[model samples]
Target: MVMIDMRDIQLDEDESEDQYEKLLRRAKTEDLTEISGIGCLYQCGVDRLGRPVIVFIGKWFPATKINLEKALLYVIHLMDPIVNGDYVIVYFHTLTSNNNYPSFTWLREVYNILPYKYKKHLKHFYVVHPTFWTKMMTWWFTTFMAPAIKEKVHNFPGIEYLYPDIPPQQLEIPAYITEYDMTINGIRYFEPDQSQNLLS
Candidate 1:
């Protein structure tokens, strides 16, 4: 089932400002943009497309009842392209390391709002939804959902899954799923409602 243990995962060493610039530069695109919920929109300097970018990380934006809904609507609005069969890259960052913070359920809600084609076109549902705080559910996803999703992506986009930063924090892991790995970058900070657009 292609299992990867969280305990075995290790984030790459910290990157310097120059290296960070290189990574960002490499990620730039005249046809693509990345939205992040990790911080303010100012950090996102590129807006080659119509809108800057719509990053949907639960941690970066305010999750208050009103704010969360606003964010969701904003996400839904921006996701229209994905809804229309256009390629849209959604890079999500969970606010908390635990399974609780910024629920993936919300993502499902976002999914439900999508038109059936887009919803059906979703080839992969890569996530870090593992058991407790250990695995990335790679095996569980493959054994159970992957096959179904594989067939679905034929009409739907093929599913591409990710466990990005597993065992989000420092923690030991079970042996069977011991291939989990992640590369941490930048100083972890918490700031809410302070981010805005940067492409203006």
Candidate 2:
């Protein structure tokens, strides 16, 4: 695993993501490929997908506010060919105690500032909501909420939903995925969204 730094992820809020990434790459060019992790740092204004190309992962879970505008700006910048395939790992900056979790307030606040195209990316999010649910909350929203959201997103134009649950081991996945995440692993293969009630 490469050792990426916190700065790599906290791109400038004013600079375009490409410029920021360009600077980052130029600065860490020799060691870019070697970095295995990074830490909390938020940037703003990105691609149409709102997916931040830069990811920050830390030993402790992320508990910091993820400047959703910044984060979504990143994601929007990453859509297109990137979203077509591959799953990027996300480590929500989890903090030590009581106050831990994405700052939804900040997220909502910054969300409006997103570029029209960036906002468009989230529009297709309905297709990936289940995975988003699994990734973000580590809980099966389908089981709790109506699978309607999942189905709705699946219907979005140009969106492809892959790995309904877990594909056979032979299938190639971008990252190592466990049937259930060890710490925050969801109840996969159990109480699937199809169950009558999530409690089952």
Candidate 3:
């Protein structure tokens, strides 16, 4: 677990600011948004198809309930202004081949409680560089999604493959994802004959 130091949190210097402002400033300073691989939504710009781009990190987020809830609320708050009744938000989700992954139950809860207006704006969902494990997890999750949402989901083998659908310039690819070396951990897929070779 990561330890947070109260002393590290910065408070606003202006005494005239209201209590809400001070509290909000503290929240921003103390939140887990800085964690690597935590789910974050940033508006990059419009894609070639004119859909607004919203980037999301899928792994490395804190698994604890309190942290997860705070992250979800933060994402929704940032996304609200960018989405409108007619706007379509293009979600670009970065998937890690190995390492951390967000909890399924937590993700389900986050999606289930989203306002219809927010959900309706999600027109496309792209999973970047899906690995064998990601494919299996995605398949399991799809069973719970509405048909409309399912239809919007697609997978890209690599960054080059995403160019045709979502212009490469609009995306803010993380350095870790860009420099991913699949060869080191590439052969982890399930093979009945080589079941013992699976990654633990």
Candidate 4:
């Protein structure tokens, strides 16, 4: 019988821990002014379940103009604190043209590097106004690379559907998203009073 060396396995584990520590250090120190200025990602408050809500406005993300590494670091920085506990993500796919979408390779790389702990604590991932491409890509990625998160992903046609899971009062939904929802749904799911209050 072949015997495995315990020393080699211990060394590998140590290296992995060191790499994660280095990543955390970079995430803390990185200057991400430009990325933050884009208004792509932010903590919007807590959901009805009291889980922290992280919102991602896909239309605002300038995938082509920004450095992917810095963008990744910024995402890590934003998520680091909250990932320690239960959290939910609201990704607005409205008005996300081809230019705004990042490369699949970049996404895959980000997914591969993220620790299991980060994935474990994410209770839900709500995609608002997801396009066909968005659905297809999400399916492909979840099916092959990240099966663990597949069940957590939910798609809603408009903002109103999100209210049942995440309270409308908690989220600072952008005017553009509301307008688009109105344009497509042809009925005001969000009342005028609610719109004014959220926009204010």
- Estimate TM-scores for all models: 0.34, 0.31, 0.62, 0.86
How far residue 174's Cα lies from its native spot in candidate 3, in Å, is 1.7
Q: Over all chains combined, what TM-score does candidate 4 have?
A: 0.86
Q: Flag regions of model 2 displaced more than 4 Å.
A: 1-36, 39-61, 65-100, 123-200
Predictions ranked by lDDT, top down? 4, 3, 1, 2
Full ranking by TM-score: 4, 3, 1, 2
Worst 10 residues of 4 by lDDT: 191-200
How do the residues 1-200 of candidate 4 rate in per-residue lDDT, one tens digit apiece?
A: 99999999788767766766788899898788988888889999787678889999999988888898889888888898889998999999999898898998888878767777778998888899998888999999899988999988888888877776677799997899989998999775654344322210
Position 2, candidate 4: lDDT: 94
Instruction: Judging by lDDT against the true structure, name the best candidate.
Output: 4
Task: Write down the lDDT of every candidate, Cα atoms only.
Answer: 0.32, 0.32, 0.55, 0.84
lDDT of 1 by residue, 1-200 (tens): 89976555422212233343343343342222223332422212212323222223323444432344444444443444443442322234332344324455664454434344544444333232223332233344334544434332211011112112111222222222222222222233212222321111
Q: Which segments of model 3 are wrong by more than 4 Å?
A: 1-39, 64-66, 85-99, 181-200
The clash count for each model shown is: 23, 30, 0, 0
Query: Which candidate's TM-score is highest?
Result: 4
Worst-scoring 10-residue span by lDDT in model 3: 191-200
TM-score: model 1 vs. ground truth: 0.34
Give the per-residue Cα lDDT of candidate 4 at 111: 79
